[model samples]
Target: MNKILRSFTLFTALSAASVGVHAGNYWTASAQDGWIDGYVEATLLLSGNLDASGIDTDVDDGTVTLRGKVETDIDKALAQELALGVDGVIGVENMLTVFSPGDNDDAAKQRKLTDEKVATVVKTRLMVAPNVTSADIDVNSTKGVVVLQGKVKNDAEKQRATEIATKASDVEKVVNKLSVSE
Candidate 1:
């Protein structure tokens, strides 16, 4: 009875070891190269054919995860298709969401109008500033955030431009990327 019990225990251990080996081999086979490679390839593939501005991608092992909002259902499906086409991508987790048309349209339009107003106000302020040169400055506003880009003669001019932008109505933030010329 002891001999039979010993044999049964050994057989059970062997079976468990074989199962582990098979599982390891299966995982290795599925993950052909690396997750990074899969991510890059999928990104390039999607970017080539799509606008790709709002789309984001993540890869784990052989599975690809796509996230972000697309304009339409067609765009969402296209993004998934592009991701799946990549080599070594065994599965695709398509988590892309479509942009809501009715609600988003009104909000986007309002935001754009607000941004335009902010930019115009900032521009007018810069023009009125005695020491600042408004000709070379480029003003762009998005969602109350103003981006001032161009060249300035000195640090004072950069500071003045930022101040002007920050004072505009509804201006939430100001990004001054103006280069001061020596």
Candidate 2:
């Protein structure tokens, strides 16, 4: 039983999905190889692809959790497969809105000078841009780095979004999470 418990704990720790970036105490995501965050960020950006079907993904360490809704079961299956294909993703969870309730008012906001209003203003700036689409993306203001995700038509669109995101006054760095369609 002790061995089983240990294994299960390891699985739980290693297999975290994007839904909850960490099991508890979400304080700046202080985990090693923080590169996992980058991989997760990249996956979310790519998911915006027209081929990606717009499944909002979350990740902690290497554990990726997905949310939002897709059009079909095939879409869900494809989403899971895509995430698994990524090099650093350790796990994938699709808690997406196969049939979702309206957007949840509850969200975590940490270490940001910009409030939701400012963030929205920034997002609106990007959304209005003809080239870059912000759907199926997660925008969090943690420590001044504006992380972007979603699918793009090509590298040009991805690069465009990164430039737009950096336009914000306090945005220190823009992490590109856009993915390309193969």
How many pairs of residues collide in model 1?
0
Q: How well is each residue in 77-111 modelled by candidate 2, as lDDT tens digits?
A: 54565555454567887775544322323333222
- Which runs in model 1 stand beyond 4 Å of their true positions? 1-105
**Can you give the TM-score per candidate against the true fold?**
0.42, 0.37
Worst 10 residues of 1 by lDDT: 40-49
In order, what is each prediction's RMSD in angstroms?
16.8, 18.3
Best by lDDT: 1
Model 2 misplacement above 4 A = 1-118
TM-score, model 1 to reference:
0.42
